[model samples]
Target: MSATYGVPNLEHCIIIAVIHNDGTMHSIGVINLEEFDNAAAVEIFAGRSLDSEEFAIRVVAVADADHAAQGVFALDAITGAAERAGISLLNVIMTPKIAAGQHWTDLRTQEYGILPDPAMTAPAIAAIVDGFGPLPDAEEITRLFTEITPADTDHARTTQRDNPRFGRDTLHEVRKTIVEYLRTYDPDWADGGVIGADFAADERTRLLDNTAEGLAARIGVLVEVSGSARDALLGLAVIDIPTAARIYTHIANQLEGIHRAHMLAVAAVLYHVDGRPFHARDALYRCGLAVLGESGHLSETMPVIGRALLAAARANVETDTARRFLALGPIAARRFGIETPDYDLYPAE
Candidate 1:
């Protein structure tokens, strides 16, 4: 019998583990039961996945669970899944205190509670051994979206000075500056991120990854450039500038009384191009929109009409409502050629 062990959470995600012949537990991925029921979960373990030797999964973990409702215990859920999969559960466990303290129980004996080794009993250590970072707590995860770092504040000021507002007549000026820099930079300068913090900056250079394919996909290129140009118009607030001028621009962005540093201009354009509406809108809240060129306002989602609505919603940007759809952005719209169609940035309601 293949032995499988896992952790179950009544309140959150349920994890499962793999027990090798040596009796050491190697943690497998967490099977989030928040969206699926026991029967569905059993199907996952039975033959096609995890144990099936599949490839990468880039899906975002989502949930619509009701905490008030009754739910199955993790221990029961995983065992039920194992049985349905025609496998045996050597010893499945679901408990708390992932961070500190020790809790373990004897799998065979009814009389003794086993205090297993700290490194062994903790699922995190096993996962780490298998090359995964320990899962972050909810507060830590939430902090990624909300915290505006000093680098963020400084990026806005510096970006603004280097790239100022421009009407359509003057938009051509960016070709000499931003465009040129994008084209001639050393490939190493645009290298993929070797570390975590470089993700967004690394993302900035992705449009150039497949030049041969990109050349064939000319229209795709236009879409990319247009979107970036629009986002650049909105995101140019990043360049550093004097405070008095910065404050004036902040007011125009319709941030009410919000300060300039909060604009998160670099992040705003990144979000806009990447199609993270919640993040983009949040950047707007901090004043990303203040960077938009006056002439750029002609388009729809350039957010010409929604300015008031967005301003009104500024206070609620911190809510989950603003961050609910953190997903991929659309492609086919990132290029520059005279051949293009005129349409709404905000399509009709």
Candidate 2:
């Protein structure tokens, strides 16, 4: 994926992606060089802060508008970014151009002009597959979390309105309900499917904030990492990860903006807390789509995907599956202050 680079204010595009040895690729996505510089650009090329140690990298800048000049690409900022980030800026490339071409030059091999089309490249394929292909479309993804065919979310909304949950007495009841439920909740949730309908609606009710204050009760119940949600999610993921993903996603769909974002984070916690990386990726990817499809709100989906990036990066056992989600990390951290950098997937931590 060639990105637009800025050499004295040229509006161009370029992309940086990594293809791991396992044939999976991740891209921080197309970056506008105009908006980046030596220091700020590190978040694009690497991460905001080192997680454990410096990450190794080999960046190949897709020369914007290849000139006949043998090797002239605007690479100073890129070179400087690598230095600042303490990474190996392995090579710079100046491809003759793409489409009906097959030769290119890199700093190492210095090969010239290669590839049929950007669409045929490894990163492009992975982007299509992982970002927007095969997975449920945005609308469907939203529905997965919000659908009331089996249970009614509007009823949940209605209950909160009619009950005046903000009352001192009712808030106490809400708090009591959550505390008691968490204390005794069967994490396995394998109660023969008979209780799922009634159980699901009750859970959805707590998550809806149709009124501004309604969201408080739900956040109160689940925001604490030490809350039983950690143990419950861990046990549920082991027993039926799909069901847990389904439940949390449904709970999130009724929310808007930051509210929806937090519930989506729960999916990351439940799956990755126990090393279910593939499940984590799928659930988060769909959750990302759900956020995008949301109406009437300018939502910040960065945290939703950021938590996914953290889960993938921290995965110890499912390296291959985790690689599928690596490219989304920087978008979460590097994007401007729409969401916080804070994320904790260990519900009990």
Candidate 3:
């Protein structure tokens, strides 16, 4: 019976039991079920069920009829032992069939509420993650600059050149001086150690990293100025020197704004990582003033100079030209072997 039931090496004391309809039970030496219902349960229990109701009733009747059978009492004891062992005969019979009828998604939902679709969530997560890095490319900067109307540029340039307090030559010289200075100091500027070539290269590789783009935008200002100057010199258009000055001033202001934004973005990243609000506002103000000073406009450039100085002062009180001189005191002393004045000496202000 054990061989037919696939219950190999059955323990002599591990009794099998069955319940019947006649309010009686029977102890069986082995299982001989007509059909298997639950594969998992069957695999767990091996084979152990009555073949049919008729067979169960006959077994119960036979046990009840024989006084010395001991099968009925043994059945009760065996059933009680199985219950105490946490084995469920009915569950073993039906679990596999029930599992086969369920869908994978249904089971997931039942186990864990609603599962999020990866397709819908991935792009949004990527976009949010990408925003923590630098800005877009130089092409975007150029595109935005090109959007400035030519008429507006002309008006600004005219205003700066014709101001009674400022002359065209002064503004022109400012442009020339800056260009020469950049050419002469290119190596020094490159060596300043603020930003390195390798850093720029790494930034360039990442589409969202825009340190190179910021540098490119600064360079683009020179390109625009040169192109405008060439057109003026060639008589391709009526060159309003004052209007040109205003345009140059506007470019300087725009560059300052870009520098400020870039600094703020960098500071934000640093703050996130280090939990320190490093005072970058002053650095930005100083850098912006330096860019404006290099714009090549004279002190008498009135409204334009006044406006730029005001902007600088608002960013940092110490960013005005006088304060700038003070900040450069060390360098001036090194170069001239004397203490430099806290302010510009030539202006006598």
TM accuracy, model 3: 0.16
26-72 per-residue lDDT for model 3 (tens digits): 54444322121234223423454545542232111112223222433
- Model 1, range 171-213, lDDT digits (tens) per residue? 3332222343343333544344333435544543343222222
Question: Candidate 2 or 3, higher TM-score?
Answer: 2
Each prediction's TM-score versus the true structure: 0.29, 0.31, 0.16
Off by over 4 Å in 2: 1-59, 63-90, 95-103, 107-109, 112-234, 256-265, 274-349
C-alpha lDDT of all candidate models, in order: 0.34, 0.43, 0.30
Off by over 4 Å in 3: 1-145, 148-170, 173-185, 190-349
Candidate 2 minimal-lDDT segment of 10 residues: 1-10
Tell me the deviation in Å of residue 39 in model 2: 14
**What are the runs in model 1 whose C-alpha is more than 4 Å off?**
1-11, 19-27, 31-36, 49-74, 106-349
**TM-score quality measure for candidate 2:** 0.31
**Which candidate has the top score in TM-score?**
2
By TM-score, highest first, what's the ranking? 2, 1, 3
Per-candidate clashes, comma-separated: 24, 18, 9
